[model samples]
Target: MNATAGHDAYANSLCRQRVAALLRVPILAVALGACSGPGADPSAAPESTAYSRPRPVTLVGYDDDAMEPFLTRDGRVLLFNNSNDPAAQTDLHWAERVDDTTFAWRGRLQGVNTDSLEGVPSTDNQGQLYFVSPREYASTRATVYRGRLHDGRVESLQRLDSLASSGLAMVVFDAEVSADGQWLALSEGRFVGAGAPITADLLIARRQGAEFQRLPASSHWLAAINTGALEYAACWSNDRRTLLFTRAGDSSNGGAPSIWITHRGSDDQPFQPPLRLSRLDGFVEAPALSPDERLLYYHRRDGQRWRIYVAER
Candidate 1:
């Protein structure tokens, strides 16, 4: 290989090694006081839970890929993506909880699902929806969009210019808004080239009046969460103090990626180190907690299809 090609190969190999090393070290944390920023009160951090064994959730009845599970603040509604028919367009769907363990399908989301793609739906207390989709079919990256949920339908779809104008060429995916709509957490995939692989990192955006602005990457808890690993699909607890997300795990243990959870003293405080949910093994994604924070919802690949699973105390 030429000199440039040789350097690229060497860089990729180093990245792979770092990811493997990170996977071996189950719980990684930065210096205890490294994240003491404004509005941070170290003594107020929430109590951490001892990792528990979680069982599979059987309520979701999608024969296709049903991932990126998101629950509303009330926990009465569910939103996710479906791609059962590989030849057809991947779209978003919703369901209403019938009981603690059952849900009634509400069918495909209207006014949001387009011929291109739509996935990763989240909402605030006011029922405003946020999701990711391409600006156009030929577009290289996807952008985050905001819409209103009225009478069980999505309305008034519009692109969030503040985030879209962050001056990054990446595809935004899996997003969650805080209960009060003041904080936005999403993942972006930065690709190497046209046919090159993509690497993802989590980003937090704060709302300013009608627009949203991203936090400086340097001030973020990137070292603890990102860690040169593919991290995404993060959702906050009802109180916005706990965060659950997914990242690449050792393949021998289960799948390429696994579920993890972290805690913070408050919204202003950076996240404490994350701990992997060892019991929820295998190809898991879309890690989310119930509105009440008593249960967790996620999905794992089963055969050629993906199924939704949940865990409760």
Candidate 2:
């Protein structure tokens, strides 16, 4: 099947599973050990300068298909996106770290999860959530929504209208708000020219007073990192100077989208060219760094449903 058809089929399957779950059906989730275990390919390996080999995350209740893992500053809390049923709405979920190798699933984040698609959560130290949802936007677009996350629940949700008014085109998703809350970076999809192949690239916008203005990609310092291929789902390191995003590639040739990182010495310097996290195998994406930058959490799809994995830095 083509990509769209395959996606639809997957959505339908998940919808059925969700219905069964709601009805108290005793369907057993696929064993996590089937994907990664003591003797599995995804089991832990020796540390390297790059990412360590991934080990599957143990999730409770919802583990069949999960992606977009984000960890809090202290690495005590984890948030990710998962679709449990045919509603096909990817809602946010959270887990608390139980130890170095496991996180106990908490549950779907209440209130913040709507019938609309929501996931890819990023937050600041102050407990504000920045995520992408397609509910209220045009069918071909998704917008960044902000909310106050308090006491483990999302509340006071609203769109960041200032960035929406910046006049970009087509779809916007996977938004990452800077630590200081003064800048934004997100994936944007649009046609390069009339009849040209459509593409997705990362864009940056900075807060100017009460509004935001999209920085010109043509001359923006980050343009170099947003290359010919699609790139999105960015996360900042603890210091906010290093950026990690997903870069797509030809899967058949072993060039599937993987996590990549770029660095700048300071706020005033331009980002250097991005480098792939080559040590971790598989189609990796959605990178989240721990507060100390020693642990990395991401999702990887290697001939299986997406699963969350962690690696030592």
Candidate 3:
């Protein structure tokens, strides 16, 4: 291989290793757009121009380092992890939303969460549960899991063997599946070292048959969303035309992970440049919207620990 290509290869290899090591840690917080085929309905979002200031979420029956809160399309079910602490062997948990900002913890999700890292819970209307876990991280490395979520139990758990696989060694730490189950937005990053910590971007995959696959056409639109920064925790709006993700340490947020958003007129168009959610700030990541798009939910660092918070329109 040429010298430049060889150097690039070496860096990629190191990236995978450091990323794996850091995957279990709580510090490094962790996709872009759908291509043609999905239709758009601008009416999904009301005439609200801004979201409310971030506030602590009153999570009943649970209080720990919350991360990656995925609310179902009906805004009834909530799936998340109790803590990001690897020492705790974090597992996915479920809850039922009692109101806009309160969720009553149901308990641990059976059949999933093992004695390893498991969080970043996501699901679609079809009851397919998707999450990231190091349960098999030693063999799979960068992995995203797929399973059936039913009756508060997860079954037939399996890694996304290909589409959201760590093909390039970049881990699929966070994911968001549209309610319609047509599009999956993944936020990925590779840890180079402590100095740099992480370099991440977003990627979108289209659903084909029973599986999800990357659309080559995503390259054009993804550019507008990636932006060469630590972008992760992708959330798709009800219409699938609007996307919200967290940008870690952008110029606007002073190196803190803050929420940002981008939108397209339709599925055929590329996304516009992302704008930071100026009203929301601080070490916050994982942007999730309510079914009606009236409320936005995310997790933020509260002192030394983390907690889930929300912002309403």
Candidate 3 structure quality by residue, lDDT tens digits, 108-153: 9999877677778888878888877755555655467789998689
Among all candidates shown, the one with the greatest TM-score: 3
Relative to the true structure, how large is the alpha-carbon lDDT of every model? 0.62, 0.63, 0.68
> Where is the poorest 10-residue window by lDDT in model 2?
33-42
Which parts of model 3 are misplaced by more than 4 Å? 1-22, 25-49, 164-168, 191-198
lDDT sort, best first: 3, 2, 1
lDDT at 110 for candidate 2?
80
lDDT accuracy of residue 55 in candidate 2: 83
Better of 1 and 3 by TM-score: 3
- Give candidate 1 misplaced runs (Cα > 4 Å): 1-62, 84-88, 137-142, 165-169, 194-198, 217-219, 249-255
The ten-residue window of minimal lDDT in model 3 covers 31-40
> How much RMSD separates candidate 3 from the native structure?
8.2
